[model samples]
Target: MRLILASTSPYRRELLARLDLPFETLSPQVDETAIPGEAPPETARRLAAAKAAAVARREPDAWVIGSDQVAELDGAALGKPGGREAAVGQLSAMSARAVRFATAVTLQRDEERFHALDSTLVRFRPLSLEEISRYVDAEKPFDCAGSFKSEGLGIALFDAIESRDPTALIGLPLIAVAGLLRKAGFALP
Candidate 1:
């Protein structure tokens, strides 16, 4: 069976590449707006499933993988900040607080499906106003959830991280994803 990744995120793409399995990437265009009364984790799961189903329809015989990440603090969703100002504001709002990043991954082929959600707790260090501004100015992580890229300088902003799968924080949850892929008949070296 062929392998497909239904996302265009560079971080997810890079993480998926670590399995050393050849796969194709496609952008699944699904409405990402959260349903009213849906929790953050459920929203991530729904979006991931929607994305996989959207791409799976295009390749009925291929194995498709879909994933999504949602960051929330105090029940408020923190989406991608479009620019520097928004990124700064997001960081400011999250400073010295605990934020949750829920990452969901799904694998599907034919009529079979497997899914998992990895929620990571990230605690940010108490950040000064100047420090937040400088970090946002230097990193420019406007497209990242929580307005910070843990793989980069953004690590300096977090005091601790609690997660079942570290890769989830990076956006893919590769351990769980790899297991799902194996179950779907993909061999990993």
Candidate 2:
């Protein structure tokens, strides 16, 4: 069966490409609003599964992979910022703090589905207002959750990252997703 990715995120597209497996991409039209009282991890998983199922129903004979990420600090969920000011505020609040980024991945084929969710704990070094402002201005990672891009300039803001799968921090947990794909009968070298 052919494999399909249900997302338009550049980061997710890039991460998926690393597998060296050919796949098609499609946008999954689904509401991403979090349910009332829904936790960050749960939200990520739900969205991932929703995306996969949405695609699976359309391509019942093909494999579909869906993923989502959520960053949470102090129990408050942080999604992509709206603009420069919001990015600055989010980064400022995260400076010198530890944040949990949960990435969820789901694979579905017909009636069978497999999934995984991985959380990466990242500790940021004490950041000056000036530093935060410069990073935001230079990278404009406003579209990223928590207002930082660990794969880019945002790495300078971190003192350490504790994660079983570093790619999870990049937006997709490739290690776990690869396992799920293999179980779903995808050939991976």
Candidate 3:
């Protein structure tokens, strides 16, 4: 069976490559606006499933993988910064605070589906304005939800990280993905 990834994120694509699986990527053109009253985890799960289903509609025979991530701080969801100023602001606000990154993954083929949600708690070390500015300028993590990339220089900004799967922070949960693929009869080992 052909494997497809319903996303345009390079980070997720890179992670999936680690599994040594040959997968094609398609951009899932789904609206990502958060629904009112929807929790962070729910948002991630809903988007992930929507992405997979969108691609599954196009390629019904292929196994499609979709994933989404949301960074939550004080009950509010933080999306991609999109700019250096916004990234600096996000990092400043996240300074000395605990943010929960909820990453959800969905795999679908025909009428069958599998889902997994991984939550990672990242405690930001106390950051000064200069530090935030420098980091933002250096890494330019404008496309990342938390305004940082744990796999890169962003690790220096964290005080502690708590998660069952460390890859979740980078955007995909390989452990969960492996289990789901195994259930779907993929030779993961």
Candidate with top lDDT is 3
- lDDT (10s digit) by residue, model 2, range 42-77: 999999999999999998888999999999999989
What is the lDDT ranking, best to worst?
3, 2, 1
lDDT of 3 by residue, 1-189 (tens): 799999999999999999999999999999999999899999999999999999999999999999999999999999999999899999999999999999999999988999999999999999999999989999999999999989999999999999999999999999999999999989988
Considering summed lDDT, which 10 consecutive residues are worst modelled in model 2? 177-186
Q: Per-residue CA lDDT of candidate 1, range 1-189, in tens?
A: 689999999999999999999999999888999988888999999999999999999899888999999999999778899898888888888888999999999998867899989999999999988999999889899889889989999999999999989889989999999899888778875
Error of 2 at 30 (Å): 0.9
Better of 2 and 3 by TM-score: 3
TM-score of every candidate: 0.97, 0.98, 0.99
lDDT of 2: 0.92
Better of 1 and 3 by TM-score: 3
Instruction: Assess candidate 3 and give its TM-score to the true structure.
Output: 0.99
Error of 3 at 179 (Å): 0.4
lDDT accuracy of residue 15 in candidate 3:
98
Model 2 per-residue lDDT at 80: 94
User: CA lDDT of each candidate?
Assistant: 0.91, 0.92, 0.96
After TM-score superposition, the amount by which residue 173's alpha carbon in candidate 1 deviates from its true location, in angstroms, is 0.2
Q: CA lDDT of 145 in candidate 1?
A: 88
